[model samples]
Target: MNVRTEIIAGITTFLTMAYILAVNPNIMGDIGMDKGAIFTTTAIISMFSTLIMALYARLPFALAPGMGLNAFFAYTVCTKMGYDWSFALTAVLIEGVAFIILTETNLRDAIVNAIPASIRNAIGPGIGLYIAFIGLKNGGVIASSSATFVTLGTITSGPGLLSIIGLVLTGTLLILNVRGALLLGILGTTLIGLPMGLTTFGGVAGLPPSIAPIAFKFDFTHVFTVDMLIVVLTFLFIDMFDTIGTLVGVSTKAGMLRNGQVPHLKRAFMADAVGTTIGSMMGSSAIATYVESASGVAQGGRSGLTAFTTAVCFAVALIFAPLFLSIPGSATCPVLVIVGLFMLSPIRDIDLDDYSESLPAFICLVLMPLTYSISDGILIGIISYVVLNLLGGKRRKLTPTMYVLVVLFILKYVFIG
Candidate 1:
């Protein structure tokens, strides 16, 4: 790719994913954490992690606090489980250290290879649906209902209507093969919403908040409890699968996967592990490779230079927090919906003819969006795959690791969860 093209691709990736800077703070803020501190932590960790990916891994993927993982950290771990934020951060730190150890040994590769090809093929599309559901909820196109669990929102509402228009316009631009289509769609939608009285400019620039309130506030008390162990294991499993899934899905599209594996795989894993470990100390959730990076790869970003550009954009974002925060869900949600389309391309790799394979994959796909949890979808898929194969008298087809994972998942739900 030309240097100019790569730089543009980087900018495009940042634009498509920048909504996280605002969204994360709001989500975490619900539980009494300082929103300003979370915002600064989000930007700084994202910048550091992306820079690591660029310089060490030489991949185009961007790293940030993952969507579902953050929800679990805030709502489940802290609010529902009634644990403090420090304990949550400690869980993340432990998970990250375990990932580093796994990366240095054969266990990581073994776990990767142990997943059946059918389930492996399903995860990308599953995540696509999960994220798309997030977009729909975030944009207020869908909402919780007392009777039905979920119901359609008022389409005539300001944000809902704007999101619909944005999705259509963005989809059209992508179909026309427009350069920077995702970025353009985001800005255009925001502009349209300004006149509709649905969005306000929070000024152009401002200094970022200090990270002192949450920085290095980890608590080691009760870190060894059964509940904390369950939390840590959940983090470890989700981060591992999510990172591997993104590597496979994005690299496959970019033609960076050789012989069914990523080139420079060790460094890629290390980048994620190191990022997660550091991000915990910096008061963020588990950092992982973003599936949204596929947007950059789709734009002809072929090397680390693309990631470097994205990292720089994040640094610039710190100064212009208002501009980014000014973008409403109507604008940014379209990018998530569109990026989901890019990720779904790998569904063709699934073996659809075999019932054992196809059934498990189908359940995995449906559960992700329906349950709104990637880890839950993965756990069910693995258990279903093993049980289905065993009942089909295909016992020899199951890997030892697959059996172990099934047992562990069952135990987790039975006792810990």
Candidate 2:
């Protein structure tokens, strides 16, 4: 409708999602991975992902490297498994290409249909809580205080005070229907935290770290290694499903779904697959559609315009890596917490009356935070879906695909455990 409202929608979407760009790299850094290049490459892919979603797919949703998969890429691939980033990148590329083929062959649709209803229900709030958890972890608001609990800072540290101010300001702005409430919430918190020295903008003191922008030697000589192929392919599908779930949700909200299904699903799938391929080639992780665009949808955006705006913002942000690199973790935490709060609003519509729906959803939602794994949440939800269906005297619900998933889930849980 109004041009001003549209601009605010776009900007808010960017801010809510921007935390991923910074946090993903930091998480990688903890595992002794390449933080500098990872962040830089991530930002660049986000720019491309957004453009494709907006201009090509023509969806209001923005795409980027998803968080859950990034942790897997860094920790599982590089650290625990002892695989080089190059070989992992090769797996990412293979998965991306395979994803494209699946979409083209209409196999992606089959996969989506194969998921049980209850498991599908779990994805929404599961991702919301997951996003919030990552936000808290990155913002330093919820640090490990004890074995089983977290201690809050006393309104002093950057994250504590900013989160407090952000909650208030973002909440108030949302109430006021302020354009870009999410972005303003973050900016407002940053401003409030500034005088307190919590949101200090570290001036360019240290010489900016330098390395080749894209440094993986095209040596896919070990692309066929069994272990590397397995991990990479797994991550590829992980990213793909997460992205698809987010897109379906956002599209439904935008009323872009035809017959309750995405019409141009193939195009959207291709964009995600291609984005992931390019990301790894550039030495980043699996790029996928972001649920953070829900922040944009919440602000009244319903067109691809928001995605285009987010892409443009990311592209513009690349020139100022030195500046973005300096933002205090607390400053970003408030934005993330508020966005999580916004994302959680959809939980009200869920029909918890049906145990079939309620059981899997509860499992998936809680497992996300408790087990600290996205895939784990999905697995629990899937298992519960099958269990609930069978026990509820609906054994006919278990398709061949469901049986396969059940066997796979059981084997995975046993082996991984």
Candidate 3:
């Protein structure tokens, strides 16, 4: 709660997830958008949106255009669905508008309340595995394989070995209860990479890239088609659950949750909705709450002041893009693995004595990482929960909203997916 500690925690959070600045542009570039514009837009939207989280909601969480959702936008929607970037951005805007409307009403809260407590409890651990998987993949400790889908990367490879070393070092620091363990882990790993030729330093400072190419580029025309509707729904679904999961997971881990629910839920939800709306207008993907904010929480950040400081740090990073971007994936990802552990603390709250509850929760926990989609994991978990309860003659326990969601999820996959 101390200001100095909060500021330091903010810096730690920002550095741990700064890779999004460079990686967002690269991924979107594959879809023919200008990389520099995407980079600038990513940073600007993240700064302003995260500022909203800090000032309005008084939470220590940060916001950014999400990683997996961006891939879906670039590769699946734009590339495979044949929608242009502008069209896809239009869908994002629609999704954001829908989110704002839902959050402002009883709908958002109802949806949150509809989720089984066991499944809600499982979200943290599920996201833990998801974050760890991302760290391993990005750090080159794991690689995709034709034979078995994924396999361990060669330990001798420069990035792979450095990541292993960083993981061990960071895990050790966490075991010793070191303050700023995540931040120190990243910096230490980056230093180790310098000698191994894994990290390259660019100039100390430079002007941020221009946002002109992508600014205000959304296309509303020709968006009334069925495909576009599906795209919008996909954006909406992912944005909804991802934000919900992160808020629940991080807040629970930070001891900010009360009565198994988030306080100020509407404000937090609006922050994410506003971010997505602006990101689409700014020509970026859907923005959501970042689970990496748990790193700040783990570092003793307890209030909005931490987020405000982190926003300031992100703004400062804009001028030193090269210096920040120079951090190798091998360096930052160790924080993900460590933060995953912090998030998984919620698992103790789950009721393992009930098979019906435990089975659905277990499915949710395992599917999140395996499917690589929080929304998908949630979808199946709900469906499974409903089915199990009904078959067990516990149908009276199901909420009306839960039944509605099960049908919606079923229709979503059948028609859109």
Candidate with best lDDT: 1
Per-residue alpha-carbon lDDT of candidate 1 for residues 1-417, written as tens digits (9 for 90 to 100) = 599988978887887677678667766776778877888899999999999999998888898898667866876678667889999999999989989999998588675678787887787688777767777777878889999999998668678899898899888987897666776787788889998998888877899878899889899998768677768866876687778878877898788888888987788889889999999998899998888798888888988899999999989889866666677877867876775676676689887888999999888878877876666677789899999999999999898888988998898789876
Residue pairs in candidate 2 whose N, alpha carbon or C atoms collide under 3 angstroms: none
TM-score against native, each model: 0.85, 0.78, 0.78
Best by TM-score: 1
Off by over 4 Å in 1: 1-9, 12-16, 26-33, 71-87, 219-222, 225-230, 245-261, 291-303
Note the Cα lDDT for every prediction shown: 0.82, 0.69, 0.80
Candidate 3 C-alpha lDDT tens digits along 243-345 = 9878887888788987988877778899999999988888989998988788888889988998998888878878866655566778866766775676687
Candidate 2 regions with alpha-carbon error over 4 angstroms: 1-19, 67-91, 145-159, 191-200, 203-263, 291-309, 342-350
Task: Give Cα distance to truth, residue 134, candidate 1, Å.
Answer: 2.6
For candidate 2, the TM-score is 0.78
